[model samples]
Target: MRFSHTGPAPARRDDWQTLKTLWPYVWAFRGRVTLAFACLLVAKLANVSTPIYLKDLIDGLGMPSTQLTVPLAALAGYGLARLMTGVFGELRDALFARVTQGSIQQVASRVFRHLLALSLRFHMGRRTGGLTRDIERGTKGIGFLLNFTVFNVLPTLLEIAMVTGVLLWRYDWIFAALTLATIAAYVLFTLKVTERRMVYRRTMNTLDSQANGKAIDALLNYETVKYFGNETYESRRYDHDMRGWVDSAVRNQVSLNLLNMGQGLIITIGMTALLWQSARGVVLGRMTVGDVVLVSAYLTQLYAPLNFLGFVYREIKHALADMERMFDLLGHHQEVADRPGATVLQADQASLSFDAVDFGYQADRQILHQVSFSVPAGGSLAVVGSSGAGKSTLSRLLFRFYDPTAGAVRINGRDIRDYTQDSVRAHIGIVPQDTVLFNDTIGYNIAYGRPGATQDEVIEAARAAHIHDFVASLPQGYDTPVGERGLKLSGGEKQRVAIARALLKSPPILVFDEATSALDTRTERAIQDQLDRIAQGRTTLIIAHRLSTIVHADHILVLEGGRVVEQGTHDALLARDGRYARMWELQQSRTAETP
Candidate 1:
């Protein structure tokens, strides 16, 4: 299995151009979308006919005193038509939502897979909580946009056009022009206010992210906060972020209220003019009393959908902003890719070599400068260096976590990057300094190294790491759950469990990174013996802070300021009286003080 670190999730964009790119995710489900559009057409036709039915009923009622029976029956039929239309419209909305949700699933799954393919460098620059929020917003945005755009907004616009046309044909140019101008004004005003509201919404999202970041920071460093008694400080900071969010929310609500008020004003003005025109036509014998009633009724019905369209329009815009952020994550280029016709490694030979390599995390600051070293096939080499001296960078390059900037790292005399990354790294095992164990059973954690490993193999590896006795002593033995990061275990116990995991991998090359740094003298000695035994007849690279850990290695390389300053056995390094000699002298003095 391959594990990848996720990068920073995309942030929301204000541009509508971003929304155009997201249309492809929905296009993948074009068949369902076509069905939704068909349903929308049927639903909208009913919506437009509803007002006409009411007009006919009003005309029938005012026709004459002797035709009461026909008008009553017509009223009943119109009511039934309205009822059926509502039912059909609701059913159509249900179908549309189902289709929309499926499209959302496809987009979200693709984004998640893409995020997992990103390189470790991307993750190092981001925070976990921000990424989580981005994904949540993205998925929700897709669902919102699909439902509103397909079922509500499109149908409403069609209804507006039909209503405008009817007024022009039935009444006169005055009524049609008044209705159209008022609607145009309503839409233009709503758009103007919405643009302002979106700014507030963006502010709210930013503050919300800050609050989540603060919470995550506190939770992950719970121990540090408790040690420093900084609970009040953290609480105050959280409150400050939340307050900013509230301020933005208040601004957004005010803008929305303004939109609603503006809509009500426009509706009133349009309806008053419509009523005045219908009354004037009746008095002049150009229309009847029933025509005035019919015109008044249809005008309000038309206004209802138009008024709602404003709100839905704002929501859709916000949703699009969210979706743009999400697709941004999916668009990130993969940091590493397999070469054309790359093949898996087939050789059993185990060797690692770095030939005049130069590397850096950034362009101007080199982490390792012109470094050259080689570990024999099935032999051990220990790399010793101070902090920031490129010891860990060497290990990362060896595992192909990163490729060297200026030279090649070869495994079995093959360039590591030339092969498929999975195949290249599969034969190497690492025991990381930070022991990260999932909240799972001890057996599962041990077997993580080789997913297909049997129960006996897991137990055997645990025994070799000197952790079997501790595991067996637990109430549930191998079945006992390890808490998050194995926090339930002692420091030395967690280290041993990590070692057992690396051993179970059974890779041809083994790596140990200051494995016993957290252990006591006796525990270190016990595990050190097991590590030495495991290193035999295998290519091993040990990075050790404690000089005693790698004292007996076949060869020791001392690094300083990204360059190799010393190379030899322990005895030879002590005789040089340089950086390595000073480090040995400090260890000797510390040992003598241990009375």
Candidate 2:
């Protein structure tokens, strides 16, 4: 359930370290925690004393001469003790509620923020479904661990101590010794069995995540699944993981039964021994019936929590296991982080340059090689190349999604690394080749380009992208839900929405990576015109497969096998009859044969 990142392996955390990590978040509300503990102590005191009162009531009722008197004082004391235990226990929960929920919120928020801050490299390799499930389970574990550790585990231990002290003081060392021995045996057995069962629990978690991940991945690719008619295949794939999960879960339950049975047996043996000793003492005329009753009452009171304590320890271990993955995610070192005191990018008209840059998704497989290019402020540079020729890589470099492996990418004559990532991204707008939109209203998706955009601004950008008329025809218009990843819309429609989004952003630099590939011939022509208009007086970098689209660009660069083979104006490149000229001729012939 852990992910490998581009750094040293994440440190393995023990249960104590996991609990320690949670302390800071819970400690923020120290006053509430203190008050809750106070309530817990008072509640346990009342609970432990209740059995004492009950024993007195029973003994008083047994007295031959006093039987008719009704033992009113002892009865009232027993009732009041029970009432106080319930009241204070409820109060403890009420006081601790905010602390539990607030800690969950803070920890969840921290993990979420850390996920966002991680580099795209980490996310690209991550399984979204599994990652989300980890976060969900981890946050739930936080609440469980906090509530149970404080209320159940701590209170149980305290009650056991108090009960054992009472027995030793009022009765004999033998009673206390037997109580402690039984507790120790029960605890040792529970710990050993639960520790062995942890493998099954951890297996269940891994399989559950795998099953969920497979299910979500299949659903996200529903169109692809339908195209290949593989619905049954997907189901079987998911069930493969589920089958393992079921096995692990069954094993977990079986082990739990074993632990429970062992604990019960230990308690039963101890309780019988204590009661027998009490009865013997009474027979020897060394103890009264009330003393025997008191011993029985205390044993009952002590063992109940002891049983609960076993359950708490097992759950706490499970909680620690669940939280390990989430904290490990938080522990991942950010692959690309801004330097300390990095300044904001200050560019009125952004000019971009990649100088002698080399990069690869992996070090062994270079994607771009010694690539150098520049687009002056208010100029248009279009790159034409076949797929995987590093055309799109140029756009990624300018956006600083990945820093160049050699040399540097500069904005306004300064290394982009010198500026904060937020500011650098803020100055650039991109309409990516494959556009994915949020599952929300079209208006909302468009406004995501520049959040809090006014309705008028959104409308203006939509009109400029040539999607306004199409949207207006729908009954819901701007309010229409786009569905997951904008699947409700056609590919061309999604592309236009992307265009509208970038237009709304209105950054000084713009990148269009095969922006019009999704559009039909007629729509392509129209959208191209709009793109041309928007390119005016902005530094625009276009990665194009179509030579026709870049015919009017101020400069054209031809990339082949991750290298810049040719660069010049359109007329200049055609006259040279080089790589750019052959690509143009091939595309032109294909276009001519289209009709």
Candidate 3:
């Protein structure tokens, strides 16, 4: 089977747009940012002045031995300049550290929360491995972009300006003109080459995410792979993605080598031309020996960061690409949103109704057609149907996971859309057919029903679900770790844990979707008793595969092909001797054959 994200595509973004999106996060710490820049300015100024002092010291030492003074002041000034440069640069980094980390935290937090707020539809179609990889790379990119752009890129430009101005003031225009032209050419060349090379980087990132997604997907379904004896097949599938990644990475490295060679050549020629001019000036007696030393010193200072500038620019571009994908996640439209001024659902005992409801996961096929149903306050409704009869869709609609295509789902006589989603959900609890537990302690999963619930409350819930005795038999009991997706426990045990969680929630409304399908007949009967006792005076909706579980429900709905075919209590439906009777007879015959 092929895997792909079926969700809506993410929007494309430009580098400037991505940077603009990130600026506010960094700017929130403007005070620290301003201070860091102050330190940077001092450091760069001191660094530029170091060369001047060195030039003076060299020229002073050229005098005859008898006429020469110690020239201790120039030496000391040079030493102090170097020291200040080191001290303030370090101080700049220290001041800016919090801003960098803080912005990363804020952006990552926002992305995480927004993901949770997104509709279930979006998440259902997403790959967990690929999605998480995107987040990891995006946050890392933010740090690189901020540090390099501020410290390396900005500082390099400042130093270049200072060096060129000094060169023009002390020497002929030829020197300054050469420096400016070389810088302009180097920047232009780096930008053009890096732009072309970005395709390789993007391809590598895409293939890497795909490879990770496949590996994680296979690992999560390890049992299936073993049952089919397809370990080699899985490896080949993963290697397919890795093969693409390898090709892209090699191409990316090759392009990088080309860029480095071009940049090195530019630096070499510029250095040669500038020094030749200085040497000619000294030979012609138009300039002093110290002037050549000054020129060389300034060139050394300027070229160091200029070469680094090329590197910083390339990485910043890569960071922008990563951030663009992350920000696209932010830009994804929310499929379901609460209306402006939506009110809180305040009913203590909620009544649910689906009024002339019509819905489908896709427009091409309708799952339910004009279905209408209601469960009054403190009443219980059980719905039974064959597979693909739209039985589970009712619970999803009632919980407002998806709104009806043509009608309204109401709670307490008001449309659910008029209330906040959180408020509406807070009033209901559910035990899903497929119970998935977190990779945490059993106690933690139980307490998740009502966060901050005391240990006693957790134990009481487990006892109610009839799983307490089994749990007590374990070496670690409530603290026992449930491995990934609760695979360490049997299906029945996981179901019992889910039932206990729902019981702990104690909401006014409850939904049990095939809640006891995994349990044995004896355990099912025992848990069913507890369910009936707790469901008293609460509105409950049960979607069941076992007819025996819903025999005592106050009202029963029989659905076939997404339409309600019959509705009545257990005795009344049996008396009708139609669809419900036949289903009951079939289940009874199957149970008898088990012995």
Best by TM-score: 3
lDDT digits (tens) for residues 94-159 of candidate 2 = 999999999999999999998888888899988899899999999999988998988888988898
In candidate 1, which residue ranges exceed 4 Å CA deviation? 1-14, 61-65, 71-84, 288-297, 330-341, 439-444, 452-457, 476-481, 571-582
Clashes of 1: 0
The segments of candidate 3 whose C-alpha lies over 4 angstroms from its true place after superposition are 1-12
TM-score of 2: 0.95
Model 2, residue 29: displacement in angstroms? 1.9
Cα lDDT computed for each candidate against the true fold: 0.82, 0.89, 0.91
Q: Write the per-residue lDDT of candidate 1 for residues 141-252, one digit (tens) a residue.
A: 8888877777678887887787778777887899889888888988998888897778777777667776887788888788899999999988987888788789879988
TM-score-based ranking: 3, 2, 1
TM-score of each: 0.89, 0.95, 0.97
* Model number with the top lDDT: 3
Per-candidate clashes, comma-separated = 0, 0, 0
